[model samples]
Every structure is written in structure tokens, then in C-alpha cells.
Target: MATLVAIGYPDETTATAASLEARRLAKDLIIQPDAIATIIRDREGKFHVTTTHHPVGAGATWGMFWGFLFGLLFFVPFFGMAVGAGMGALMGKMTKGAINKEFQDQVRDLVKPGTSALFLVIERSTPDKAVEAMSQFGGTVLKSSLSKETEAELQEALHGEKSAAEV
Candidate 1:
């Protein structure tokens, strides 16, 4: 089962930077993430989401390929490609992509306007190492599926607290 974690940051830039760091941490085996999304609440209170994956583009590309092959039979390759790409893009937009909009909106409400949040779908991870990696870019935990104790420990980790000595 994948756990969702949303960490709120001061700004869009910081959230984006932290998302990149989290990706790097995943690559380093510090954290295992199924998906990572960045949500930015603009100055006007509008929310926008940024993702590393491009599902629409992928869908269009595949549609174009299939369309071209089918069009060859009808001698209307360009027309088929155009129609297929459009349809595919529409489908991609309508379908549920990687990011969960409901969860995103919920997290968005948790963050203040002009702030940003990093939403992650985690499969599993080494908590200590992942927390350490995120400590440098301290953020407030907006929401997470982690247990209360683990979440509190993560908060402490973000504050750079190492055991009782730091406190």
C-alpha cells in the first residue's frame, strides 16, 4: 500500500526544490516514492500542480503511432494523426492520472495562500535516512498516512533534533 505525504513549504520555489531533493533521495534509496507532486497556491489563491511525468504527452504519442498505422489503410495519415492525438489528449485529461486531485485539493486547503506543498506517494523507505535528507529543507507536515509517533518523529527530524541531546 502506498502512503501519501504532503509537506508544506514557504513558497513554490522551495516546494519545487524540495520535491527535486526528495526525488534524489529516492534514487539514493533514502526514500522509496511511487509518485511525487508539487502543488503551488499562487498569490491569487489559485492552485496549480506540477508533476515530473507527462501523461498527456505520452498518450498523444501513443495515439499518434496507432493513428498513423490505421490511417495508412485509409490514405489519410495526417488527418488520422491529428484526430487521434486530440482524442488521446482529451482522454488523458479526463482520466485519473498519477496525481490524486482530491488529495491534492485537501492538502491545498491545509496550506496558506502563496505557499506550496510537496505531495508524495510513498511505497516504503528508510525513515531515518529519508527524514535526514529532508531535514535540510525543513517543511511542515501538512498531511501524511504515517502513524502519530512516526509523524512526530519526522517533525523533530525536520527541526534537526537528534535524540534528547538536541532538545
Candidate 2:
């Protein structure tokens, strides 16, 4: 059940500012609430909102691999320690390699101009405050949500039953 709510702000900074203002106005749709939402500001200065469902620990599963290698290296002795150290070094290099590649891609984007997408996990009740805050930045609010009928239709499709795609 995804609801698309639009909050308009004049610029990114203003939108960011409204996060503070929202406290006085709405107080519920606070940015960085629970560290659940990710704010992706693209080069065009548009805000993209993504709710992190399965956040892999530290650039994905690499965290666990590195952790295990260290555990083995520390807890084990002799050949085990040697093995741990070797594996640790290999895993560390591998982790660094992946991070570097990702950073390179990000670096290519560089410091983009204007405001990027400011993400927020808005509940059903705080729609008004979200709208108000976004508008403070001189932006427009466009609430996008699926109606009950639409939801039913989507559910039907999901169940592989019937759909309106025919007509």
C-alpha cells in the first residue's frame, strides 16, 4: 500500500528548512525519522524518496564477511589465525574494491546543482503538515494515491485472477 504524497517547496534548502518548520506544523513526518527513509538528491535537484526495507549492513553483505574474517583471525590460533588473517586481508581488499567502484560512480555525479530529492516516510495522518512544509519552499503539492477501487484491481491482478487490462 504505497501512497504518493506531493509536497512542494521552492528549493531544496527551503524544503530542508521546512523539516524544522514541520515540527511546529505537523511534527510527525520528520525527516530522518527512525533512519528508515533515504533522501536521494539527484543532479536535477529533485527529491527521490526510498524506504529502506532490506538495508544491507555497510554497503550490503560486505560487513558480515569482514566481521567473520576478523572473528576467525582473533578467536582462532596458528593455522586458523593465519587463515583468518589471509582471508581477512582478501575480504578487506574485496570490500575496499567494491566501495571504491561505488564511490567512483557517485563521484561521477559530483556536487549536483539545486535541491535533490528529500525523502520522508509520511504516515497517513500527517499529510497536511507535509503539504504545508513542502509548500513553504514555494513548491506544489500533488497527492498521489490509489483509490479503493484501484487497490482492489491491483490486488486482483496480484492474485492472478482478473484484470481490466482487456478493456
CA displacement after TM-score superposition, residue 143 of candidate 1 (Å): 4.2
Which digits, one per residue and each the tens of the lDDT, describe model 2 over residues 1-111? Answer: 223343434344554554445444433434323223223344564434433233232222222332332233222122222223333444444334422343323422432
TM-scores of the candidates are 0.51, 0.33
**Per-residue lDDT of model 1, residues 48-124, tens digit only:** 66655323332343223223322321232343234443444333432333234564465545567789877664546
Cα displacement (Å) at residue 125, model 1:
1.1
Q: Would you list the clashing residue pairs of candidate 1?
A: none
- Evaluated with TM-score, which candidate comes out highest? 1
